[model samples]
Target chain A: MIVAEHKPLKELLALVEGFDRILMVGCKGCVSVCNAGGQKEVAILAAALRIARKRAGRPIAIEELTLDRQCEPEFIEWLEEPVKKGGCQAVVSLACSIGPQYIAEAYPTLPVLPGLNTTFMGGTVTHGVWAEYCSSCGNCGIANFGGLCPVTRCAKQLLNGPCGGSVDGFCEISPETPCVWELIYERLKNLGQLDRLEAILAPKDWSTSLSGGPRKIVREDLIL
Target chain B: MSMKTNLKGILEGSGFAVLAAAPAVCGTDLSAVSDFARLLKGKVTAVFAADNPGARVSASALAVSVKLLAEGVEPVLCMTTRDRNRLALESDLLGAGALGIANVQIVNGAHPSLGSHPSAHRVYDVDAVQWIAAATRIASEKTLISGEAVSGDPSFFIGAAANPFVKTPELHLPVLKKKVAAGARFLVTAPVFDAARLATWLDNLKKSGVTCPVIATVAVLPDAATARHLARAGRGMAIPDSVIARIEKAGDKSLDEAIAVAVENIQAVKALPGIRGVAIIAPGSETAIPRVMEAI
Candidate 1:
């Protein structure tokens, strides 16, 4: 999932300072699961903004709306009616970076502010811990390393690893972090696929990654 | 047609394999690098291609290596694990092999954030040791990590970097062991400013059972700023107070002082055991090479 964290209150307050009324948009997407920009989080932010404005003697009005997903225009179109009726001047998007960008493009006349800093594509590791596990390089080679993605797992992103910096199965960067290559080596050893370690991985074809440009996929059959 | 034939006299006569260290190839003027290679010609055994020296991304080291090879100089490509992923690194190795480049120095590259592209995403997919191991596999198996076969005799002399002035040289011994175990044939120390400390570190390395031929680095520090810059550049590399004082006292004659220091360092390193050669690293002061070589 795309992970993100809320921007500081000071910055958000500064963003909507001149606006008399504003819309706070949330997403039921990755931001919701990460507890960053979900419905609950949007409400909390709206309440905080109200209290902050009241203290500042401004007492601005706010209209909170949670969208299914802010990235798609179909969900974004839901805001047109509410924004027109509510007399809101600006919008605050609590979703990942895509949400605010989509809202900005959808309603170019109004100012759209981002409420969260879009972080890496990651998953919840434990209860509150989230670890990044993929680089989204477009080319996937997890099967070669016993399903451990070196592009995301190894600090150096080396196709071959262990770096001699691993001690007691922990990475050299931090003792708390387990060396991913060590894990892969152990897994390969257990699977009796250690010979797979002998092959050299080639340099990636970067045309598939951001090296080329913004990437897009189109299915000819699905298109009208 | 043979490149090594021209290098035989210099390699045999000096009793030391001198490697001319090129500056970082990022945004490099290749013609200048080629000219420098031509200038040194038969004076050096090989030219070492450096990665982003100031942490700025530029042309790939493999690119520079090929250019040097074209100039009729044997090239040792420097591979930094900080930017390119495993796939890119292996491709570069194959490319180097195809170009008849035979030497590679593997080092954990400077973090991308440290360079001009501070916001750039870094890919430290593998550290230097793993890179060495991977390159070794490519040289021997002639295949890639994805179990794909590549056509090339990617045979290479692997090299790794060492820091003599590290906080504790003893602590870095394990890293050296890992580097050698990962298939590094030789080691290059960070530029030596303090000969006694380097001698002590060499003794410790020997005691730790590391028998790889070490190439001592000697840098020409033309000024106090250059001294400080090198010290900061190497990350924990020490510049002795006495050496700094000498450069400071030399005032306008700092270049001469740097030359004297480099010459003195070469002499001291030559007296030490286990050192196969001395690599002279002078960025803007290539003229000092001749003086240092004359002393040799």
Candidate 2:
């Protein structure tokens, strides 16, 4: 899922400056699952921002609301009433990076401020610990590496590793992070698929990735 | 067991010779390197290809090798898979070969984080072993591992590096085996400070059936400060305490002591059974090559 984290209160306060009334928008999709830009976090940020502004002798008003998902235009339409009718001059979007853009496009006049930093598309590895597992290279070939993604996991993104610097199954960058190739090796070894490590895969076609710029997809059969 | 007392003697009967590593830095003075290489033109066998030494990206090694080859000097190109993917590597192999550069050393290289551009994403699409495997395939079959046909065979004299000072150095035998099996024609070890450690490592390699020609590395530090810095920054270059004390006590003559120590190391390393030659790495002290080689 897309992962994001709330911006620091200091930065958030600086972003909403000059705005007397603010609407805090949250997302129930990826942000909610990651405990980052969810409804609960929106309330916490609203309260914190209010306290910070009040302490600064410039008390402001904030309204909290969450949508099913902020990236989609249909879900973004839900914020029209609060932004148009309510006294909100600006919106603080606590959703993935795409949220603020969608909100801005929906309410063109209202200032849409992003309250979260979109980190990566990853899953919660453990409680309160999130690790990036995919590079979203627009190509998925984890089946070849025993289900481990070197593009995101290896510090060097080595297609064939562990490099000479790997120590005790740990990456050279940090001991805390387990080397991805080491994990792949163990996984391949266990599955009796070590021979896959021998076959040199060709260089990745990065045109499908961000290198090729913004990507879009349309299914002809599914299209109206 | 002192086989040779000088560089000339060291290269007298062996297939290898002392090659100088011309490290490329952010603002590398290539003229100075060219001058150094010229000074050692006939004195040494060849100059090492600039493999982005010190992990800093500089002029391509192939460019340097081509330049040196034009000057009638052999160049050994160090190809680290850290910077390029398989396509770029194969291209470089073919390019180096076209430039008449034969020797190529494959290594996983230092992590890009250690280089000047720490933020640069490292592309280790293939490690040293896999890279060698591809190179060997390109040599015999004239085809890349991807089955892409090349115009001509690179037939590179494939070399790989090993660090005997790493933790439980003997355990690296399996890794050495993999490299040799992949395609390493010869091997070079990390700089030696403690000969005993390397001896044990070599013994283990032999026991494991490694018969490739092993070239020992002898790093020359100019002073105590350099020694300490290398010890801290280098991956497997641990300076022995005894050698450190000797350097510290030498005071104004520390460089002389370092050279003497390096010479002594060359002697000790040459005595080892499996070691076929020595490679000298004296970055700031390139002049010391003549001195060390004079006594090799």
Candidate 3:
């Protein structure tokens, strides 16, 4: 899932400062699951913005709405009616950067602002904790290392790692982060596949990753 | 014969090899290299041009290595996987070979976040072991990892870093063996503050069948404050409380005590069976290196 967090309130306040009225949009996708840009968060942010504006002698009107997901065109169409009603001069999207980008593409006249910063593609590790698990490098070879991805987990992203900096199974970057190579080594050892590590993995082909360019997917058979 | 063979000969020879580290060789001045070479001329074996010590950005170690070689000193260019991809690594190796810099120390560098640039993206395209393998293939096989022919002789006397201070040295054995298998001719342990710990690490290395020549590092602390700082930093570097206490208790003689401690460790390191040399790392006190070497 794409994890995101709210931009600072000051920054959000500045984004909608010039507008007399604005529509705040939220997404119920990964952001909602991470408790960042959910319906409840949208309402809370709207209230906070209104209060901060009112106290500053510049009370602004804001209409809050939450969509199923902001990345898709179908969910984005939901903002059409409210935007057409015409008092809304700007839009504050509480989804990942994709939502604001999508809104800007759909309604070219209005200024679409990002209310949250898209951090990483990650999953919930605990009740309210999330950690990055994938880099979306487009090349998946985690199976060889017993389902662990060094490209995403290791700080240096070395194919062969647990560099000399690995101390007590923890990464040199932080004590909280486990050395992924150590995890892979231990996992492969337990599975009796330690031989997998004996062969030096070749240098990664990063053309499949963001290094190539902005990526896209097209299925010829599914195209209408 | 290649410079790599000459270096290997020095390492395998009965005379103890003395490597002096010249950290952060990024400035416009080559005087530091000349001054260091002049100071250790007859006494030292090679000058190690470190790659971004403390993760701070510095000039390429190969460039510094070239400078050291020009100054009549053999150079050990420290190349880290932290900054370059395999192509760049190979290109640099080819360039180093062209310049006649023979010795190369491959290690996974310190994370950029630990350095001056915390926001910089890291490119650890290859790990240390894989890099050692790639370097060996480039040198001996005369082919790049992509199997393209390397034009010139890029032979390297390859060395890899080993952290002797890890609490459990046994867990580090497999990787050590893998490093040796990957063509690391020698192993350089992280700075040793405790000789007993180094002895234990050497014992473990011998038992694990890693009989390669080992160069142990000894950091010369100038005072109790630096000792405390190193102890607190703890990046797989072990500075036992007893060692720190000795420096602190020395009062006005803290600097002498620090040098004495380094001298003592160098002697103990030299006595170890698998040990080939001692690399003196005196971060800000390069002058103290001669004293340590003289005492050892």
Number of the top candidate by lDDT?
Answer: 3
Each prediction's TM-score versus the true structure: 0.68, 0.82, 0.95
lDDT of 1: 0.78
* Clashing pairs in model 2, backbone N/Cα/C closer than 3 A: A158-B124, B5-B296, B6-B296
Q: Please give, as one word, the docking class of candidate 1.
A: incorrect
Worst 10 residues of 2 chain B by lDDT: B1-10
Tell me which of candidates 1 and 3 scores higher on TM-score: 3
> Residue B231 error for model 2, in Å?
3.8
Per-residue alpha-carbon lDDT of model 3 for B1-296, expressed as tens digits?
35544457877676677898975666777677778888887788888998888788777788788777777888898999888888899888898888888889999988998788989988887888889989988878999888999776567899999998875454567778888999998999999977887888888889878998999999888688877875665477788889889989999988888889999888878888878888999887887889999866
Residue-level lDDT tens digits of model 1 in A153-180: 7765666544434445555445577778
* C-alpha lDDT of candidate 2 relative to the true structure: 0.79
Clashes of each: 20, 3, 0
TM-score of chain A of each: 0.93, 0.96, 0.97
Per-candidate fnat, comma-separated? 0.11, 0.22, 0.51
For residues B16-40, could you state the per-residue lDDT of candidate 1 as single tens digits? Answer: 7787676554565777678778887
Candidate 1: segments with Cα more than 4 A from true spot = A1-20, A25-60, A64-91, A94-113, A118-224, B1-15, B23-28, B168-171, B232-234
Q: By DockQ, who's the top model here? A: 3
